[model samples]
Target: MVQLDATTQEVLNRISEEFAQKGAYNLRQNGVALCHGDSEHIKIRKKEDKPGIDILIDGDTKGERVFIPVVVSVSGMTDLVYNDFYVADGADVTIVAGCGIHNSGCNESRHDGIHTFHVGENANVKYEEKHYGEGNGTGSRVLNPVTNIEVGRNSVFTMDTAQIKGVDSTVRETNVELAEGAKLYVLEKLMTDGEQKAESNIEVCLEGSGSSAQIVSRSVCKGHSLQTFHPKAVGRNKCHAHIQCDSIIMDQAHVGSIPEIQAEHVDAAIIHEAAIGRINDEQLLKLRTLGMTEAEAENVIIENFLS
Candidate 1:
């Protein structure tokens, strides 16, 4: 196990709490990496040619699921990390990864991460990631992330990502490809306050027979924040795809949801839906009847809606 200072530990704890990370984990501060875990079924190693780590899950592994958590905390610096994951056939694993910025410096802090996943036949993978920022300084906290996923035949992949608060700006892009009998599910949640801005673009391709993909996005924008969500699903064969986007905007906040569904084959099927609005008055009034203040009631409603 690697020892961490008080400030770094606090950042890790926040990341853990937000993403529900437990058990085996890895921590990276500034640009240094520290990892601790069992090596029998899960292997984590730094990449000699890159600035990040590689996680490998052995083949034919079952029973207890493997968990890998990664955290990055830095201030007044731009950090870049590249993570590659390989899951062998019939393996099941979960990964929790996030980044937090603790900036009390004069310069802005930022993090850019690229993640790629290779899932083998009959494997199942669940991945979750969250981003947060906190500081009393005048520096901006920015994050940009790119994800690429490839799932083999009969495999399943689920990805959940959330950016709850404290980020100044972020742009996220995700691309996924599914083989025969493979399934991909994506859930994206985001909340932005202050003058923060966020943009997310996701594309999924169902290229094999029996392949399916679904994407659901939820977002809340407050205090002049701006957000945009674009999710596209393409079916190239006898497959199914669906996309849904929902958002809430308040206090001059702006949000846009654009979903595209394309069917390239006669047997392909695709559907999409989008909705954007504010807090429901009935929901708020019902909460207020419980002796809560207006602000408190709104908060409760928003939390429930996002959850």
Candidate 2:
């Protein structure tokens, strides 16, 4: 692993300390690549024409993990990066990625990331990501991430993402395509407070027979925050897909969930579920009766809901 400064380590610790300790890892700061480490099964290389990297995972690689994390602490800085991944056939591995920002001046700090992944036949890939921001500056912390994934025949792709806390603004988008006998599952969690705003849009296309997919989202909004979610599933063959969106609203917060399904074949099966509401009064009362304040009760309910 490469040496890190205090600011970099602070942001890494907030996201995941184990990421820096991983054998295969890449760290990017400001507008440059800081350091990257490669393992026996994974190789990370900087892109020739872009401000990002290309990761190649060996075939049949098991029990291996890769970490790709970026941080922006300089105020008024805007960072954009494009990263790609190639996973060989029969490989089973996990990839961790996210961005952290801290602004200490009166200028906004923003990071935008575009990632594309290719999964080979019979491969299994699990990807995890988290976004976070913090500082006492008047500047806003902004993040926008776009992901594109292609799952090969008989392959499996699983994605889990979260917005932990302190992000001022964000727009998250994802697109996925699956081939024959492929499987996909995605779970996203988010929390916002104090005038924060977030929007998420995701679409999945099942283009081959026997393909299946499921997408689920959970979010919490508080203190004048606003959130919107759009999740869609498209079935072009004899496949099945499901989308679920759920949210909790509190203290003048606003939330909207729109789910869509499209079927192009007779044997296609698709479904969607959307629910947006606030904490239950009875649950809050019960918690309050247990010697908890209203704020504490609400926090507990929100935590459990997002969890």
- Measured by TM-score, the strongest candidate is 2
Off by over 4 Å in 1: 18-24, 63-72
Model 2 has how many clashing residue pairs?
A: 0
Report the C-alpha lDDT of model 2 over 47-113, residue by residue, as the tens digit: 9998899999989689688999899989999999999999999999999998999888899999999
Which candidate gets the maximum lDDT versus the true structure? Answer: 2
Model 1 shows how many backbone clashes? 0
What overall lDDT goes with each candidate model?
0.83, 0.91
The backbone clash count of each candidate, in order, is 0, 0
Clash-forming residue pairs, model 2? none
**Model 1 lDDT tens row, 119-208:** 999998888887888887788888899999999999999998888879899999999999999999998989999999999999999998
Candidate 2 deviant stretches above 4 angstroms:
none
TM-score of 1: 0.94
lDDT of 1 at 228: 91
